[model samples]
Target: MLLVFFLMVAKSVHRIGPTEVGLVTKRFGRKLPDDNPIAFNREAGHQADLLMPGMRMKWWPIFTVTKFPWVQIQAGEIGVVISQVGRSLPIGAKSARYRTEFGTFTDLRGFISGGGEKGVQRPVLPPGSLVPIHPVGFLVITARHVHGLPVAPEFAALARGGKLVAQSFKLDPKQLEVAVIAPHGTTDVIGLVTTLEGEPLPSGDLASRIGAFDDIVALETDRAVTDAQVIDILMGTKNGLHNNYQDFQAFLDAGGRIGLQHDPLLYGAYLLNPFLVRVELVPMLVVNQGQVAVIKSFVGLPTLDTSGEEFKFGSIVAPGHRGIWQEPLRTGKYAINPRIYAAELVPTFILTLNWANAASQAHDLDARLEPIVGKSREGFIFTIDLQVQIHVPDARAPKVISMVGTMKNLVNEVLQSAVGNHFRNTLQALEAVKFIETREQVQQSAHTAVTRYLAGYEIETKGVYIQDVVFPDELVAVLTRREIANQERATYKEQQAAQTARIEMEKARGTADMQAELAAAQVSVDINGNRAQAREAQAGGDAAYTRITGQAEADRVQAIGLAEAKATEALGVARAAGFAAQREAIGEMPTALVAVAGAVAEGKINVVPDILVTGNGSSLDGLAATLMRKLSPAQDGQPG
Candidate 1:
């Protein structure tokens, strides 16, 4: 019993090891301030000064010493300091203001002299930090351990029950570690920063830019701001000033606002203070080939229209102004803060919009479009499957977006109405057959109309095509029947031609089969023709001979008649003259009697002997005597 008493007395001389901290408490002293749990003037409660690693002698009855492990932060972890004994925190302030002289809150006298308030400290203990924090004045909470003494009744109760954790102060264990915003395999990400401890954001601002767009105002005042200069001004950030919010006091000193930050944390690890800043991982903006990102800034200078007076749809401004930027981000990845800026991707290539059942795989602007349905002039309904190709020039993409708001809106609103209504009205005034036959003309007209319409929105109409035409069922049936009838008629005509050809072929075949007999008959006919020609020549020769003989006889007879007539004429002339002379000589009757006597003397006077009997009577005896004389002559001739 005496040895135990001696050992208890020897406990007055405390020996603190190299890895331990000695927290001193005054057994008898003046009362500490009501607001301060620690005594800086050597007054009551727990003393502010911590005993370092060494032998420290405190009288056993007057002082008490409690050994504690030094505050230790492991790798990939941070220690958040919460002050329990300092000046009361100012109203509306959630954390104590930090000072450079505080020196990580390791110097108790300096921290108290520097006017450190009592609450959570703004600065955090970074990974691998080792310090001897005052046990009663502050509490250090780490990911896996709590390293300071709990002086408050509730904290002491929770700590005794092993329930005093990093979460008890509303700090997430994950947040205590370093923030990583780097590529993981195929996923590239960025950290969007939101500061919890700073001055409130400016009025009418959704986010807080580093310089509050002062640079933007300067650029806007200058009329000769180039795109590269604008881009450089917009890319400037204040992250370097605060060491990525690892130094929260530096962030506050640099005029960081309490809201979403304008700039996002890029590809790196950050030691962000959980009490002051929170980070959300989001996908980095990727503008691919054939595409452009049109930035609409929600945080920048007051909008000043860069688009000319001719543009009335919306304000188009330079890159850093608070409106749709005229210049676009083309084909690259950007770590843009989504909360501060909205990026609308506009394809710079030709975009095909289909007013049909099909949707383009490259874009979804045409997904909601259907075939154009209209009625023809004859009340025939028709469905037209149309496709329109448009291009948004890279330079004009922002203007296009400003006018239409989005590519989908360009399809769904302006182009849809223009194309569909034009076709409907065109079909309403055109006959179905005429429309089908003049599809090319109609497509060309649609191209012209759409070109004219989209030109107003700064969109280039590449082409407009009528992909297919679907006629009404009744019209289709009628056309099919007509086509079938026409085809049948053509088939019948072809069959008739085939039959005529077959008949000709049969005639040729028969002619070929009877070739020898036909040749013999042709030879016989030729022989008969030759014989008939010879007979005709013989008949011609005989006719010629007979004609010559008749001609000669007629010529001879005519010559003889002409000579005899001439001789008779001469004899008559002589007689008439002789008579005339006789008449003159004797009387008219004596002339005639003389002519008769002369005629009798010329005939040998036979007229007187035979005529004497004939003139007297019937002359039967004379006739008998003449007949007897003739008979006697005949008898004489017969006898000779």
Candidate 2:
């Protein structure tokens, strides 16, 4: 009865938080048959099953309970799980997909039974929401950010296949970021990948594409030494999606081809798995200004039938593929894989091809080429300075590159050889001395002839400049002597002409002196005769003036008398007409006088009156007073 009571008291109870989980362990439990107590078992030591929140029962001082916070993951983060206790993982992606025994990390019993791996987990716990878990059951750890792991140097020794050579075969988080290949500068280059994992590269192919060349899987695959390998190769090419190689999982699922790609990477930085792919940076074929690059593909299809045109029967190719392309790459940058095509840069400018010992054009096609020397008809050994300007238009640059390989090749092989042979043969037809005089004609003929020849090679000869025609030493000396003799004869002839001109000039001067003396004598005689004639003419003019003056005076008096008489008669006639008109207007003389007297009376002047009247003054006053009285009555029209 007392032991039973003790047993009831031993049954102690405990509770857990709302979001928390309880990890309980039996102090004493079942043991395996014929063996000591197991450290971890279903009914022993640490129980695989976890206690739920808010409830728990345990024997007093026997069973133990420990509470743990749930796992919380924020946005844009992941929880990389590490199994403290579990089995190993299978080989591929779908191996641990349908889990019953290892039913995720939530259920410790299922996880133990599901055969989960003990190392870094393949699947990651995504962000958002908390995950309640037991501390003893499974250790739930966040990604590298949540927990600060030690960083390994990027210069860590790498394996032969480009994977990082792990220290003593340990799996670390740094191993996850195994390989990366970033482009350095603005130079264009392509990534050549050779995968060491996956299924072996197809036949002769050395690589494959799983996701990106630097994908984790690809890195893992590349890291595969014979012991721990996955796929052979994952290429950086063949993806219509996945934001470059950032989405590693998507790349692998897409099943990209693994090998040397046709298209190349321009200027940019890139992440790469060195173990998954071996990359070699090759320079781009640059087509500079005034030049064109012909692209000739080495791989693909059979030969095209170009026998009738610019190409031979077996050397035919399609444009931009198979063989030499008709359209060339203009002056610009091109990210072409050097392994696939051959480039021949043909200058499209007017190139001056020189064949002279001292020729120094910056665009010298062949610096090692010597000057052109030919034999004259007289067997004189002479050297010719030849400069031919040639141009290959944009339309024909491709044909030029294909036919003769390059501009340098054309200058060395076609232009130099043909021009040398033609000049050598034509030059022998003329003497060395005659070369200077006939140089213009020779240049024209050569230009015309070379143009036709180079037309077959698609090069147009613009012009040919004859810089110099150097003769042998002996021939030069002889020509100089002949020129001196010719100058001597010319000098003698000019002196003779000068002497004859001088003699004629002296004779003309003597004749001019004698004529000067005769002109002076004639001038004096003419001066004396003109003075005499002047005096005689003056006297005759004076007499004529006097006689005309007397006649004018007499005529003046007669004219004056006639004018005075006529004026007097006119004055009398005008006075008479005026008086007759006045009488006609008035109708009576006495009435006209009264009208005049009335006007005088309106303007009558008053005389001073004296206290004592003088008789003369009285008379004058009486006359004015009487006249005014009479005129006033008349003006009033009253009869007096």
Candidate 3:
């Protein structure tokens, strides 16, 4: 009893530590206003004035002092203050309206006098703040702990049961710390903000723009504003006014709406009230090389068609309007809120699409495509692997995207039908052999047809190639047999030619073996012919000489014979004349006798017939006698 009396006496001169605040509750004061739980004029209930560090004089039994640890907000942490005592909040307001004089909710008197409401305060205790707030009038909730007295019955019961946590106020423990949008690295990210406490979002809009697109309207009205300039303007943020939702009063003052926010959070730490503002980290819109991002804005000015009447595919608008923008974002990373604006990436480079078994590694647009199968006029089925190269002009990407909705749609729907049907019809019309022979012509025709068809969609056809052809098994077998037969025929012809060549070669070899003997025989024949010719020439010369000599000798002999004949004739004539003279000179008989005697005497006959001419028989004697007489007479006559 004596110690209790000492404690009550010591309480009259209370001492508050440097890190503590003394919350004074007047035990016998006037009743507090019904609308306010705290007393600013020393009424009953909890007193709005806090006892600062050092000392305080509150008479015992008249007032009670309870010491509370000073609201020490740690680094990287914020304290959300809920005011237990103030004027009632206006309907539809989620938090207490804040005033400049409230000054971090440390001055309770100023907060009440400045029309502070009784609820969660608009401005929160920033990081590293050491504030001495009246513990009974306010509760500061942090990530790791909650500080202050529970005012309501349910809250006090929960606190008593150890269930009064940060989640009790619909807040995660980590949310009490500062919200950080980290710097972008390999894949950039952006924070999409969603406000929990603000005016409901306007109808027909998915998100809330702070100024409600008035800036975009002004930009759209300006004739000199370019599409790129409009995108730049839209990227500019109004986070400065609210200091990235750290100052919730400023955000409310600036007409911030609830639900999805148009402006996204860039790279930075923001002390946002978890109960008021929620951030969702999402991937930034990245338009890579060889691509353009066509923006379809859901939050912008009213839609107005910029594409002329000739374009019947879809409506195209300027960048700030609520439709597909004419200009696309070229190869860049954008920190755009995807909920408000949808971006479709359209490739501006040559896009090769294959109608084959394999899908392109660069894109999946042809993943579902397969080789075209068709029957020829001969009922032969054939499979064709084709490749179609198309180009989407950067200037016409928006129109092309609007026409087909996506590149995959262009491949699967439009080009698939155009190319597949054309090839099928073409194959069906042609015989298998004709199609094989005129494959190049078929490719050319397909290219022309595809070019014309894609031109209608404002797309360019770069090339159409027939990559491979898979003929039917029956056709392949027939072709293989025919080719084998042709090869066999060529082999037979070659064998026949080899046999003929072998015959000629054997003949040449036999001739070559007798070459020396043949040469010698030819030389001997030549020698014999030359000798024969020489002999014939010599005989001819001899014959010619003999003929010439014989002719000359014959002529000379004839001349000589003629001359002798003349001479002889003359001599005979002379002799005959002499005989005639002799006969005339003598008488007939006497001339004879004288001639006889002269003949006998000239002949030199021997007169003496000495037994030389003895006649045989009787005639001999008579002839002898005559001869004796003739001899005697001749001798006598010669002498005469």
> 1-640 in candidate 2: lDDT tens per residue?
9997677565556687887776666777675333211135645566666668876776656677667667675554445444544554456332122243443478755665566544444344555647765454443344233321111222223223343323323334342332233444865555443322233334543223343233332343444332112111111234345334323334344554445544444444343333233345677667789987777765433445453563542344434225665556677766556776677777787777678775556666767566788998999987888888888987777666767776678878888889898889877998776776788888898999999999897677889888777889999898899989999899888888888888888877776877877688779778877887887788779878877987798789778978987998897688556645765777545654554555467765333333434565756776667555644534544323
Query: Lowest-scoring 10 consecutive residues by lDDT in candidate 1?
Result: 631-640
Best by lDDT: 3
Expressed as tens digits, the lDDT of each residue in 512-608 for candidate 1 is: 9999999998999999999999999998999999899989999998899889989989988887787778778996666655655575568743532
Backbone clash pairs for candidate 3 read none
Root-mean-square deviation (CA) per prediction: 10.3, 34.8, 16.2
Q: For model 3, give the 10-residue run with minimal summed lDDT.
A: 631-640
For each candidate, what TM-score against the reference?
Answer: 0.74, 0.48, 0.74
| Selected candidate, larger lDDT, 1 vs 3 | 3
Clashes (backbone N, CA, C under 3 Å), per candidate, total 0, 21, 0
Model 3: runs farther than 4 Å from truth? 1-7, 11-15, 55-61, 157-161, 183-185, 200-203, 220-222, 486-640
Which runs in model 1 stand beyond 4 Å of their true positions?
Answer: 1-5, 9-18, 41-44, 51-62, 152-162, 184-187, 219-225, 489-640
